[model samples]
Target: MEQLLASDALSDSGKIMLGGAVVGLIFGYCAQQSRFCLRSACIEFWGGQLGPKLAVWLAVFGTALLATQALLANGGLNPQDVRQLATVGSLSGAIVGGLLFGVGMILARGCASRLLVLSATGNARALIAGLVVTVAAQASLSGVLSPLREALNRLWVVGPSTRDMAQHLPDGTGLALGVGCVALAGALAWRNRVAVRTTATAAGVGLAVGLGWAFTAALSRVSFEPVTVGSVTFTGPSADTLMALIVRPDVVPSFGIGLVPGVFAGSLAATLVHREFRLQGFDAGTGTVRYLVGAVLMGFGGMAAGGCAVGAGVTGGSVLSLTAWVALLSMWIGAGAAGLLLERAEAIGRRETAQL
Candidate 1:
C-alpha cells in the first residue's frame, strides 16, 4: 500500500477506492454464489427450519469473526480509530433501528446487499427497491428524516470507552468467541448437509470482509491523508454512491463510492457466467407497496442503527462493539416477530379464500 501510494500512478483516494472495489468484487461474487442473505437466514431460523440458508449465514458470520479476530490478534490491524469504537453510539437507535431494518428486510425480501446482487441479475423489483432504500438512507443522513434519527439517537448514548466490548471482557475472549462461532457454524453446516462448494463460497464472504478491514487499515497507516477503516457495508455507501452520481458527479472518489459499482459489476459477472441472468418484475405475490414501505424503513432504520445487516451485524460485531451486538440481537428478535406475523396473516388470508 505504501509503495502504491508512493507511486504517482493514482492519487491516495483512488488507491483506497480501488482497494475497496477489489474487496467489493470478491464479496459480491461470493455472496451471489452462496446465496448468502441475512433475511433468508432470519426466516429460516424463525420458521424453525434451520436449513441451508441459515447454514450459509453462519458460515459467513463465523468465518468473518475468526478472520478478523486473527488479524487483530496478530497486530496486523488496529481498529481503535474505527468509527464503531471511536465515537459515541446510541443504544436506543440500535434497538429501534435494528427492529425496523429486520422487518423491512422481510417485507422487501432482501437486505441492501441482497437487493444490489439481485439487481445485477436483472431483477427490476430489486432495482426499484434498492433505489428507494438509497433515497431513504440519504434522507435519514441529511435530509427529511435526519431530525427524527437525531432525536432517537439522543435517547440513549454510550461513550467510546464503553462501546468496545473487548474493554470489558477477558484478554482472549474475542478469540474464544470467534472459535466458538466457527465451531457452531461447522456443526450446522454439517447437519444441514450444505454442499462443500457452497459452504466454502459462503466463508469467502467473511474472508472478503476481513480483507476489506486489512486493506483500509494498512492504507490508513501509510497514507498521508486520513482514511476511514471499515469493511463491507451498504446503507451509507449506497446513498453516497447515488448522490455522487446524480448531485455531484465530480465528487472526490472514496472507498464507499467505488464499492457500490464494484459489487454490481461483480454480481453481474457471476450471473452471466452462471447463466442466472434473467429479467424479473413485480408480481401479485410481491406487492409493490410492501417493498416501497420496506425500503423506507430500511433506509431510516439502517442509518439510525449506525449500520445495516452486513455493516453493524457482521463487520461491527466482528470488532465486538457493544451497540453492534445489541443491534444484531434486536434484528433477530424483530425478524422473528415479523416472520411470525407475516405467516399468520398469510394463513388467515388462505382461510378466507377457502371459505369464499
Candidate 2:
C-alpha cells in the first residue's frame, strides 16, 4: 500500500514532465492529422507546388518567433542563460552535417518526428528505425562514436558563439521578427487562402511550437532545478528518453525527454480516433536495409549539425540564427541534389529497358 501510494505521487520534475507531455500530445495530434513533413515540404518546393504546406511551415516559424520574443520581453526567460538557445558549431559543420542529414531524410522517407508518428500508427519499420536512431544518437553523443563526433567537430576553427537572435542582432531583432512575420502572413494569405482542416491544424502546430518554447522558459525560470528551454526537436530527445527508460538516470526527466514518449502516445490516440491505425513494415530486405542506413545517418548527421529538421529548420530558424539558416539552406540543396540524382538514375534505367 505504501509503495503504491508513493508511486502515485508526482514530484516537481514529474509535474514538468506532465506539462511537456501535454505539449507533445498537441504537437503529435496536429502533426499526424495535418500530415506535416519537412521532407514533403522540401519535395513540394522542388516540384513547384509549394502551397498550403509551405504556408504552414512559414506560419510555424513566424508564430514561434513572435511568441518566443514575447516571452523574452516579458521576462519569461533569459536567452543567454538557456543552454539550448546557443548555437554550438561552426559554418562548416552546419553545412556538411545538414547535407548529410537531408540525404538521409530522403532515404528514410521521413524525418525524426515523422518516424515517431509512423511508429505510433503501426509502422514496424519506423519503430525499428526509431530504435536505430536512439542507439546511434547515443553513440555519437557519448558512447563509442563520441570520439568520431569530437574529431569532426574539431575540424573547423572554434569561434565565438551567439545565444539567440536578440543577442546576435541586438539592434535589429524586432525588425527581423517583424519582417519574418509579415512575409509568412503574406504567404499564407496569398498562397494558402483556403480555410481547410489542414490550415487549422497548421495553425495549431505553430501555436503549440511557440507554446513549447514558452512553457519550458517559464518553468525553467521558476524552478530551482535546472531545465532546458527549447521547442520541438527529436534527435537528442530520442536518446534522452531511451536512456531514462532503460538506464533509470538519477535526474528527473526534462521537457524533451517527457515530450518524446508523449508524442508517441498522442500519435497513437490520434490514429485510433481517426481509425487510421494500420500495421506497416518493410515489404522486402532492401527496404529494411534502406531504413537502417537512413536512421544511422540521421542520428550522426543530426548531432553533427546540432539539430534535425525541426531543430534547425523550424526552432532555430524561427530565432533568426545565421547558423540555423545556413544549415537549413544546405539541407534544402542536399535534398534537391539527391532527388535529381534519383530521378536521373530512374530515367537512365527506363532508357536502358527500352533499348533491351
Per TM-score, the best of the predicted structures is 1
Candidate 1: 10-residue stretch with minimal lDDT:
1-10
Residue-wise C-alpha lDDT for candidate 2, range 1-356, written one tens digit per residue = 12221343665477567767887898888888877777777787787876765666665556666765666677665666544455355566677778878887777888888898889999988888888888888898999888887777677633335535456567657546745764765566477673566666755666677777777776666666776678787889888888887898574677787788888988899999999999987785446777888888788877877788877777776655666677788888877777777678879989999999
lDDT of 1 by residue, 154-237 (tens): 999999999988889988788888788777777888998888888988999999888888888888888788898998999999
TM-score of 1: 0.97
| TM-scores for all predictions | 0.97, 0.87
Over 4 Å off in model 1, which ranges?
Answer: 1-7
Predictions in order: lDDT: 0.89, 0.73
